[model samples]
Target: TKVADEKTCIQFSIRRPKLPSSETHPEEGVYKRLDVAAWLHHLNELGQVEEEYKLRKAIFFGGIDVSIRGEVWPFLLRYYSHESTSQEREALRAQKRKEYAEIQQKRLSMTPEEHRAFWRNVQFTVDKDVVRTDRSNQFFRGEDNPNVESMRRILLNYAVYNPAIGYSQGMSDLVAPILAEVLDESDTFWCFVGLMQNTIFVSSPRDEDMEKQLLYLRELLRLTHPRFYQHLVSLGEDGLQMLFCHRWLLLCFKREFPEAEALRIWEACWAHYQTDYFHLFICVAIVAIYGDDVIEQQLATDQMLLHFGNLAMHMNGELVLRKARSLLHQFRLLPRIPCSLHDLCKTCGTGMWDSGYIPAVECTGHHPGWESCPYGGTVEAPSPRPPREGKKGPKVPRDGFGFRR
Candidate 1:
């Protein structure tokens, strides 16, 4: 099948779900800066809720105010413990800063030959990606923007700190949002470490990890959006492999939404209140919401790629989160969830178990979401390039999507 180009994909209209507001559910509003502080104060005064971070986690699930995300994210990313006091947190920050500096010093102390080899092997890619990542955002808009250089430095230092994973394509995309929030290079580096440690999507993920996530996404689609699942199945092996969704999952929908909206979605996923793999439910929500075009047009693999690829900022982040939350709630309520679904839920963190289902809880970038800058220009949502031919249908290059391993 011939692949559609940007002009063609832009002409294809897709449905957008109704955007929900705080008025829709009185309790569904984001947790503000003061509210975050109060939550911590109450924790200290009351001395541990029965479930430890249960109340805090629930509040985070609703969403966090952009004003306080810098404060709250460390907890969500596991950089700071929920139980730590102000003094303890301060002390830990000092320690982490020292450790980060030591790593930097070690990098500086590398022999000239060692430094040259490192640049050729890792720093080159980091430099290339940092420049292109989120250039549209004012924070990273200028060529001389120190934040850009900071991103390069953090990723490079990370490569030194963890030689095993070294670096990969999506690492910069993951780091940019954290750096924007944390603001400090050293702290951003550590929070990023915490993030990479917690999430399966970043670094050089093992093929097994990728396969497991793809399987879960497929099974969840089957359980929740069976019709869409069947439509994809009809498209053949590419559909079944869900290579398109890999980009969605790998970058955590950063490329799929605008900068501000994408950050909102990210913190909610990091909350992991009901499930660590909430991002998977997000993938399901997107397909369920956006798949009508693919199915109705009978878009073959290439066309489907063009259709979804063009859906970046055009998508309503709130609507996607709402649908994703509803899908998660419904899945939790199911009387008999398949073991595959249950196991999938358990893969990353605590999720609803087979033990009587929890009744309910409500909640819910830039380049904003790109590693290699899918936009390819200043446009908010640029059309994606046509897929490259390979032995296994259309495939993005390893560096482009970062799933080589």
Candidate 2:
């Protein structure tokens, strides 16, 4: 077996079964509702041959399991949302329903061109009034934009569902793009539901502790790929936690990725990497892409803060994704190295100094590239504490890891 000195690798043929669909299932089959076309198209883009892939099974949190040949796609359908809802709306909903009813009631008798025009009007109206809202309809506008209503519901519900952790600002930013992609309010909601399932671990209940969770996550990463953990810390700041990363944490990179790239990432996440693979990959890829760049770019404290401030807005999503995929491919071809989602998933459930209750992703600014300039005499540094008239210098809260603001 060891005839050659080349690094031994396992050629894993990944075969995922087709999932069930909302339209195709019978009354008894687990409420089938997967969007089959979407899933298949996703696979085609990944260049995977279903038959050959059957040999390389995935190791999920629940453990490695297999489904029947056409059952793959449908398995995730139950998690997708496919209809409209009124769960979280307060008042304006009635008027909106009336509006939709009017739109639907008609068009049955309209000419083809007329139908197109009607739909065009619908889209325009939704974008202008429903999404952004004008002053006249202040009553109709709530935090929930009808376009991304599910994202709001799911995110809020996630907060309520996991009372331990509540809503954060970046969450809204993340959901915005998702809403843009999913036209059906209900489907978007359910797709969001499935998306949130894998995130539950991040919101542990009662007597919850940060160290316990993060430690487990760390061990999982250590068992699978310690280099990833090490690489993240090399970023010179709090590794992935440098900018609070609220953008990547919420909406799952919807805000972090450019619009064009965001859609493709969403399709892929909804299709195969349903867990936090995309989320963690975003951070890992960021550090890797800018490791050397940061060394040269973050020349001063303001420059460093500005560097990270703009990170959310600067990621080249496509390039990073390509790198991640290439890395996975290379890892897969090894005869002995196994492909695992542990490092990736661990990140999903725990962020640096994030859980506020866990230590797994202890966020300490160690990476030299993003650290604030030493407090000596830089002009960009905060002015010397003015004579504190009986007041104390601003103090910072230190996470267990001792990271300060």
Candidate 3:
């Protein structure tokens, strides 16, 4: 008989369970891991009394079993909300598949000129990252591996899918782990889309979003660790940039930690039950873990960057998460929270304070009472007065629906 083809080999490799049979075997009784039965129970009870919180806490404290990540990730990413019934989730999946197909078809029909630029960028940028991303792992190892090709296809598809954001460095890192768990290319693509919209908002070429996140990070550090924040600031302007952390925030530490640990951190961050910016607290946790070293050693900006680089691939995910929770608890105990941080949390719809604290009020921009509101109120509601003659209003960017033009 003739040997199996490359595509067949790739499909076989991807379809294989990420976890060995022994690990998933119930007879062995791995109590810590979330199993299929438990997942189904949570699925059935989603949007019920405290079900979302309980499920999130389970995943946060103990990650979804390797066997179940593919099923669990979609829920965590909000591709299917907890409120959706089984039938509703199925319908949503169908709708998403149709949307993805349209996007793929659009990519295929792009003119030669349009394809040329993307192809060249893919060749030099994305392809290079694909080869190096998780190469040591068996999933992507070996020459002409189908998994590698799948990654390339997904990235290329994403480039066309969201031209405004386009393909950027480190995206391959973000998508590789997702693909490792989610075998179906289309499912992986949509999961990735959800991930980008929800957590990875800083990938666009526009700098405003990233700048805002950095501002939040800076404020978080100052509020949480004043001495270290001041020490870093005293180093110089470059010190304040926190350049070492850009990857952590943008990619959610995907490159910084081992694959398994990164996935655990991701699930915890996706919970968003605590705060939309919990990831920032995670950053604080990592910093607190190493802050003593930096302060004691009197490391300057460059030295601190070197110190952080060394910590990559060595930090403990669970320990950091625990520390992050502590930091959040401390933040809550503060008598007064900064308005900027409060506004940031409000913008993301995350509850920053305890239930007793005044809930964030939506500013209509027209409300006279908004001035008294501590939550940075912007007058977005139209001015009561009409525009003066010959004066033009601010132009809103036309929504291209992810098309480049």
| lDDT value, candidate 2, whole model | 0.37
Q: Which of the numbered candidates is closest to the native, going by highest TM-score?
A: 1
Please tell me which model should have the higher lDDT, number 1 or number 2: 1
State TM-scores per candidate.
0.78, 0.41, 0.76
lDDT (CA) for every model shown? Answer: 0.69, 0.37, 0.67
Where in model 1 is the C-alpha error above 4 Å? 1-11, 19-61, 203-207, 347-405
Write down the lDDT that model 1 would get: 0.69
lDDT of 2 by residue, 1-405 (tens): 111227532221112222223211121222222244423432433333242112111211111122221223223333312221224221233454454344334435568896576446343333343344222233234665454444444454444334344443344444444345444444433444455454432232232433333443333333334444444456644553334333343445555656556554544343343234433444444544544334433233333334444555466765655544333322222222111222433343222111232112222233367454232212222322222122222132111112112
Which pairs, if any, clash in model 1?
254-369, 255-369, 258-365, 259-365, 365-368, 366-369
Candidate 1 C-alpha lDDT tens digits along 1-405: 234466554346756567434212223444443355555555655333234345545544556666777877787788888668777888899999999999999998999999999999898899889999988877789869999999999999999998878888888999988888889888899999998788655424554677878877887777666667788899788878876777887788888998777777787687776677778888887887788777677777766777888787689888787767666655544433343444555453454532433222111012334454332222232233332222222122111111100
- Native-to-model Cα distance after best TM-score fit, residue 60 in candidate 1, in Å: 4.6
Candidate number with greatest lDDT = 1
Query: Model 2 — which ten-residue stretch has the worst lDDT?
Result: 55-64
The TM-score ranking, best first, is 1, 3, 2
Q: Any runs in candidate 2 off by more than 4 Å, and if so which?
A: 1-166, 199-241, 244-246, 273-278, 297-305, 311-314, 333-405
